[model samples]
Target: MKILHTSDWHLGATFEGIGREEDHKFFLNWLIPFLKEQEIVVLIIAGDLFDQTQPSAEAQRIYYQFLLSVSQKTDVKKVIIVGGNHDSPTRLDAPAELLKLLDVFIVGGISVDGKDFSRYLCSLKNEQNAVELVVAAVPFIHEYRLGVRTSMHNESEIHSLFKEKIQNFYFDLADAAEQIAQDAPIIATGHMACRGSELDDAPQEIHMIGTMGGLPSAIFDSRYSYIALGHIHRAYRVDQSNAYYSGSPIPLSIKESNYPRYVQLISYEKGSKAKTVQKIEVPVLRKILEVKSNLEQIHSILLNISWQTPMPPILAISVQVNSYHSGLDLELKNILKNKFQDASPIIAYIRQIPAKSDNNVLASKEAFSLKELTPEQVFLKMCDTYNEIVDENLLQAFRSLLNEENI
Candidate 1:
């Protein structure tokens, strides 16, 4: 069976506050051709179908349009999509019966017993082979939904409780997979960071743990043919070849600038134990670029890289300017948006100030003066000013990280 594993679509997502509708459309255009070339029978999108729980009307329109376009372009027999934290499980799965008519299975949210949606079965055909595959859809399950009741008295106990809860989830998932498969080659799809996989620094971590269960090492063993995971933005392998994450097609944020964005193509033979996986980078509407430059240097770089008509919304442009250059925020934002026809550019500017000398002006010249404060110190100071309870524990952790980085 030839399948495509991809996740974290985050439809309606904005790059630096600029909508990603055009970029997503471009993805569908490339995706259809790729599927045709590979003759992919199954398309598995693990999760994060949308960037918000309640997507805007425009978001809904684009999402439905993309699905319709996919159905039109490829001979793909089945499309399985789960829900990530950013998605509204109910909304994504609202028209399940309607979508099933179009051969799309959307598993938005799971119930208390780890059963929110039905198992999907699809027949995949290659040149001289045909096989049936069963997919156990496990959407993003939060700790509360696990129905885990824990009353731990200490840190160690809390960790143990968490571990036990995770084990139960995996057990439930395994049981569900077995019941759902009913002898067909089993494939699992969900939105969770397995162990040995780096969690993309997304805002989701601020609220809930992606999933209770870490990577299941033994999942690479018998019965389960493949595990398609989401949550992490960068698609990668975790335990082994059987488990994979097809990363986000577009750069979700500036921090994701370094990762090469791509999707995956998986070719599996039912009778055989091995599978083939390929990564495909979709053509993007606008290229995301990042550069760190000082104030004196950025004007030239901006002019050199500036767009004439259509341009990618700039994000978090790091700049180094003289400390004396006060209040350039409004001017900088105007220059960027006005020229590029974007909303606003994300900024990360730093000022370069010389060390204070002995003769430097002081409120009281009774004590010795200190040299220039580093960027790390500047950040901590700002944090302190903004946050009322900048306590010692968080401060110590931040300091340790700064010291480790030699910042």
Candidate 2:
């Protein structure tokens, strides 16, 4: 039986203010054909199906459209989707009954009744009606939903409770899968961050709830044949190849550009203890480039950009300067427009980096005591740090509110 493992689709995500509908559509289009070509029987999307908890209507449309296409276009018999911290359990679970007809199992979250472990355990069978694989589809467990009562006052106690609850949850599911089909390979799915996983210095949000530390990889026992994980956006193995993160199908941040996006195909022969894994790289639908240089260097690079490509790359430019220069911004924008006239480059952001001397001037100020400043002064200083202008009317309103509160 062949199963394709992928995660962190993060559909409906936008790069800066620009929508990624087309990028995601391209990925889905490419994936459907690959699934058919590979004759993959089961597809497992570990988590984070949507970029946000409440996805846009278009995002929902894309998701359902892909699922419908899979059923109609591919030989895939079973699909397992688990929810991540970014997903709304209710939203993902809404089409549970309908999707079940398509042999797509969605585990949005843990059941309200904690005792019902059957929901998380599923069995996939071959054409002959024999169980070929057993899956423990565990979704993102909100720490509070784990039903562990612990003193929130003590940090160590809270971590202990969370660790215990999470370990027990998987333990129950694995136990159930074993009971159902001991011979069948038990593949487990998780949407939480695991310890020892490498994280990129990207702007992507890491969903850390309650505690900062991740669950130890040791939590996944040897009983399971393979453990598929999500949350961390980089594809890597945890402890061994048997446990791995498929990562996101597309890059979510600039730091992620260095890592190649791909999905893993796992094949297991009937009655065989070993499984073969293959990495299938996903094609880059669009380019995300981060350029860092001085103002002159940036100008030269932008002017020399080739227009041979169908579309210009989405760029994040960081130009070092002695101070903020409106001329430099205008020049870069005009150059980019002239270079790629038909398809204008999407500038994700233009960060202005003050020169060392300028930084030294700013750093020369002695650290002011917060207690010495008035509320209005503190607010103004905070706004200055971000180069934001504080409106006089808004400042007055704040002062009035402060006076009324007798502070």
Candidate 3:
């Protein structure tokens, strides 16, 4: 059977502050047509359908509309929606029965040990092939739901407890798969990380924390036909066909700059030993571009970039300017406004300059200038400035009063 594997839609997400409603709409518009053309039967949205646990009303309406549209437009038999860290399981799974009537299966917020999960072996006839598959759907496991106590001291201890609890769930899932699939094939689906072939760019110094990390590959055995994973935002395979993460539908962060956002079309044909696999890329609305250059070069680069296309609302625009550019601070803002305009979706514009010479001078051409700070730092500084301007005298008086009391 032909299945479209996609995840991390992060609907209602904005690039910086710019809205992604258009991007989401564009995806839905193209997706319906694509599914029809491909003659896809199952569409597996692995997880993070929404960017936040509590989505906005408009986001909810649009999300439901997209689901309904797909159900109406395609010959799709099942749309499996799992839960990721960003989704509230209760919220996504609320209208389960109603959605089932529409042929959409919302499987978010599932617990590993929870009874009455409604997961099982199912069969469908596609061209009389009698596609038999057992589904073991696992949602993003929150520690609180799993009954794992956490008065732990450090990352390692916390991770240890998490692993122990989650592994039991995996074993239970395996047992279920073995029992249900019988001679039929089994496919495991989860919104958790499973040590995919790609390495996360997260620092080595860091330890697995809460839902941010994933289980190792060893935990996922070959008993199942394949394992479909989500959470990580890049399309990657753990080994080859056995396990894979269908990255986010749109580029969510600047770190995902190089990876092309896509969905995978997986076709499974039963083999003597293993299931034959085919992976095809389903193109999305936005293409992420990363350009590095100085202010002068950037001006030229922006002009060269075609903003007319539906660029991703989430942009990580980085600018590397000379530290001593007298007008760079002011020019950068003007350039972003003029070139990007209000229509452009530039979420962040990062400016980095070479470290200044320790020799401080008013006009040494390389003096420490503008007091280098991050965007967050800049905001804090502005707040500090406003506070000083408004309450400087009052703060001094309070300090003096405290000093007198101490004396």
Candidate 4:
């Protein structure tokens, strides 16, 4: 049997501020043909089907369209989708009955009863109606969903309790799967952060039902033939040979620009213990180029860009400047305009890099002083630092609050 493993589609995500609808459409269009060519029997999407919990209308359209295509257009028999932390369980589960008729399985989260481990266990059959694969479709296990009541006040105790609950959850589901299809190859799907996995971007705040830190890779029981994981954007293997993260199909952040995006294909026979895994690379629909250099270097790079394709790649330019130049941004914009007159590249962002300064110099009396500024000035300075825009009305509101505080 051949199964395709992919995750973190993050549909409706935006690159910086630019919408990724085109990029996602390209990938989905490409995926249908590939699945047919590979003659895949099952497609597994680990988690994070949509970027946001409440996806936009356009996002819903794209998601449904893809599902329709896969079910009707492709030769693939079955698809399994799990929910991530960003997914709303109720929303993903709303279409459960309808999608089931099309041979698509979705595990949005734990059932309302919370302790029903049987809900996560699913058995897949081939055209002969013989069960060939057993999957424990465990969605993102939040602590609250596990029905564990903890009175422990200590941080360590809370962490330990959460870990135990999660481990037990998986074990229960695996046991259930084993009971139903003991002879078939068992596969488990999960959406959670696992320890020792590499992250493509700088760590962002992740507050979920489980512990703030990731769970150990050893948590996955060795009973399953393969474990498909999601949550982390970068593709990598966990401690065991059978455990792997297929990663996001598209780059979600600038930090992930260089990471290769691919999906995994697994083939296993009825009685064989050994499974063959293949990494199928997804073609880059569009390029996200990040350039950090001096003014001259930036100008050269932009002018030298080969614009052979119809659409130019998005550019994120960061220029190192010793001091502020009045028309520097305008100058750079003009340069790009002159070079790509026919087809202008999308400018994602432009960052100004201030030169390094000595700490002692900054502490000196002559250096820039925040204490000498007024409350409004300080607020405006903060806005500049965070690259936020404050309208006149908002600025007035801040001033009024400051006045009330006598600052």
Q: Distance from true position, residue 301, model 2, in Å?
A: 1.6
> What is the per-residue lDDT of model 3 for residues 281-345, given as tens digits with 9 covering 90 to 100?
54546645555666677677656566435563344445554355676545655665677687554
Worst 10 residues of 2 by lDDT: 201-210
Give me the candidate number with maximum TM-score. Answer: 2
State the lDDT of candidate 1 residue by residue for 209-304, as single tens digits.
222335454534346677788887877787665678887887776656566678888776756656777877665655556655666566666555
Clashing pairs in model 2? none
lDDT ranking, best first: 2, 4, 1, 3
Candidate 4's error at 58, in angstroms? 1.5
Off by over 4 Å in 3: 112-131, 153-160, 196-214, 239-241, 270-274, 287-293, 306-356, 359-407
lDDT of 2 by residue, 1-407 (tens): 78999998988888777788887888898999999999999899998999888999999999998999999999998899999877888899999989998889999987888769788888987678888888889887766577543323244665677677777777777788898876888999997777665434222323322234666776786788888887878777776646888888887766666667889889988677589887788886776788888888998888876533235678888777766787766788888888778677788777776555643674334334453355666888888999988874565455444433421
Model 2 TM-score, all chains together:
0.84
lDDT of 4 by residue, 226-291 (tens): 899888877777765578888888777665657678898999976664698877788756677887
lDDT of 1 at 309: 19
Worst 10 residues of 3 by lDDT: 201-210
Candidate 2 off by > 4 Å? 148-153, 198-212, 306-310, 358-407
- Please give the distance, in angstroms, between residue 64's alpha carbon in candidate 4 and its true position after superposition: 0.8
